[model samples]
Target: MRLLVTGGCGFIGTNFIYLMQERHPDWKIVNLDKLTYAGNRKNLLAIENNADANYSFIHGDICDKTLVTNIIEEYQIEAVVNFAAESHVDRSINDPAPFLTTNIQGAQNLMECARQAGLEKFVHVSTDEVYGTLAKNEPAFTEDNPLIPNSPYSASKAGADLMARAYFETYNFPISITRCSNNYGPYQFPEKLIPLMYTKAVAGEQLPIYGDGSNIRDWIYVDDHCTGVELTLLKGQPGRAYNFGGAAEKTNLELVRELLSILGKDESSITFVKDRPGHDQRYAMDFTVAQNELGFSPSVTFAEGIRKTIQWYQDNELWLEEVKSGSYRDFMAEWYGER
Candidate 1:
């Protein structure tokens, strides 16, 4: 497959690229990224340096129609797998405009360009956050659930998802959308919960827990999410949306305790912090559609995935340091300094 993967330098996108290179060595991949503060070029150093690499990296924005169109024509692209967006909830809360511009407008632009280019497939990577929070006893979210996004980040994604569906309906564009649960694994930016906690815990810094730490999420391994996306690109029907979940639900407190146990720490290491505005209470996804139709289900357990993720951070100390420096330092201070 000749593919154009936007946001290819980011967390999940990087993992997907690695998997594709390993399993489908002959496939050519063009990675287009805006190289935002969160987009670390170092994530794909190996692929860039490999003599036999079939990878091409372009530093640009997806909102640029000319650049995206040129890439499609130049690469003879057959498929588009969009993983690009301003994805941090805290960041989105601090500023929603960027999220709206990149997630909603950028997505629409990509789809329009792809439609005009007559691409064979467009796979939109989305999150379960679009379904909003669930009550403790409420059923997990399914593809049919009404979108009730509570945060700016999720609201933008929901808009993009609807746009993708509309494109398929109105233009007969071939598009598949995958809504996944929380993902934790290698190459993840440290600002997120798992890596942030892991980084702080290792440094003997206080691990911040928001709003009594009871918010629940279903955690899927990064590789598992990548696998589901691959399946969607390969087998999913147009105009259909698939939910990919790990079926592993853990509260924020429970997850922290587990990480503490793994790190030989105690509860004293954690500090309670005021929760962000409109924080969802819980999220769980029913990925039966992906399981039944695409033969996609998470293979990594929470315990195993957590261990692997922590180990990855521990093993790549230099990378951790590099990522933590520069703009990330300012971000950390600004976010945590208030707490």
Candidate 2:
């Protein structure tokens, strides 16, 4: 397959690209990433170093219609999997403009380009936050759940999902949307929960918990989410949305305590902080449609996944430091200029 993967430098996108390369070595991949603050090109250094790797990277934005259209024509891309978005809820709240531009407008651009190119498949990767917060006892969100996005980030994603559905209904475009739970694994940006706590704990910095840390989230390993996406790209029915979950639910406090235990840190290291605005109380996913139709199931349990995640961070301290220190931006500028 000739595939175009957008935002391929970001966390889940990076993991997804590696998975595809391992599973389908013969496939040609063109990765388009804007190299935003969170999109570190260093994440795919191994692929960049491989002389025989069938991968190409384009430093650009998904919002550039001319660039996107030309890339589709130039590469003869058969399919597209869009992983690009302003994903952080706090960041989105701080400024909603980027979220709207990238998550909604950028997605529409990709879908329009792919639609015109007669692309065989298009998968818009999304999040469970689009369904809004769940009560402690509410049933997990199914794909059929109404979208009631609570934050700018989730609202933008919901807009994109709706646009994708519109494209399918209006033009019969072959597009599938996959919404997954919180993902933790290697190459995840340190700003996220697992990596953030791990880095802070390692540095002996106080670990901050929001609102007594009672907010709950279902966690999934990154690779498992990638597999679910692959299945959706290959077999999902057009205009349909699918949910993927790890079936592992953990409260913020529980997760932090577990991390502290794994790191041999004391609970006294935690400091309660004011929760951010529009913080979701809980998020859970019911992926029965994905399981029944696509034969998808999460392979890694949180206990195993979290351990593997911590070990990966421990082994890649240099990478973590570079990210934390903002050195990668300098390297990226140099790399881009040289290209």
Considering every candidate listed, which one attains the maximal lDDT?
Answer: 1
lDDT of 1 by residue, 1-339 (tens): 899999999999999999999999999999999988789888999999998999999999999999999999999999999999999999898889999999999999999999999998999999999999999999999999999999999999999999998999999999999999999999998999999999999999989999899999999999999999999999999999999999899999999999999999887988889998999999999988898999997899999999999999989999889888859789779988986
TM agreement with the true structure for every prediction: 0.99, 0.96
lDDT of 2 by residue, 108-225 (tens): 9999999988997999999999999999999999988999999999999999999999999999999999999999999998878899899889989878778889999999999999
TM-score, model 2 to reference: 0.96
lDDT of each: 0.94, 0.93
Off by over 4 Å in 1: none
In terms of lDDT, the poorest run of 10 residues in model 2 is: 330-339
Candidate 2: which pairs clash? none
